[model samples]
Target: MRLEQWSRIMGKLAIDDEVLEEVAAAARSRGVSSESLAQELLLEGLRGHKSKESLRQLMEAIAAMTSRDVEQTDSVELLREDRDR
Candidate 1:
């Protein structure tokens, strides 16, 4: 979407130029338009704000997967282990 369209949709949120530049740089690095990246960030923020419990559950799931011990294994495997336990 065009910058003007994004501005119209986002209204008057005072984002600093330096932060905008960083967002643009990151978007470029990821091969996505800055507008799209900004939209994703906006949507993510909205979701987190509107339903913090959902976000908390998502974070917990991610942490469970990432912080699993060697013996713990993947979530699917963990589930099976739990069933057998």
Candidate 2:
């Protein structure tokens, strides 16, 4: 691990008291700091969002492929015609 990875940059984050309590409890349960728990949750959410975007791109590509006529027709006949030439 890099030295920077171990360093924490202080930043002010706003959360309701109930939410803060929940995160604190979760952190305690996981044996990690509240800040670390929050960071982990945030990263997980970001990764999920990225996965959604990738899925959307794949869906669009599939839709595009289905929208077009891509199948080759009369393959044997075309090959025979070519061979005759």
Q: After best superposition, candidate 2 residue 79: deviation in angstroms? A: 47
Candidates in order have lDDT scores of: 0.78, 0.74
Best model number under TM-score: 2
Q: lDDT by residue for model 2 over 1-85, one digit each (tens)?
A: 1223334454455566677778889999999987788789988998767577889998998778753666656789999999999
Per-residue CA lDDT of model 1 for 1-85, tens digit only, reads: 4445557877756677777888899999999988779889989998768477878998889887865455554799879999999
TM-score of each: 0.46, 0.50
Candidate with the greatest lDDT versus the true structure: 1
Worst 10 residues of 2 by lDDT: 1-10
Q: What is the Cα root-mean-square deviation between model 2 and the actual structure?
A: 14.3
Clash pairs detected, candidate 1: none
lDDT of 2 at 51: 73
lDDT of 2: 0.74
Which residues of candidate 2, in runs, are more than 4 Å off?
1-9, 51-53, 60-85
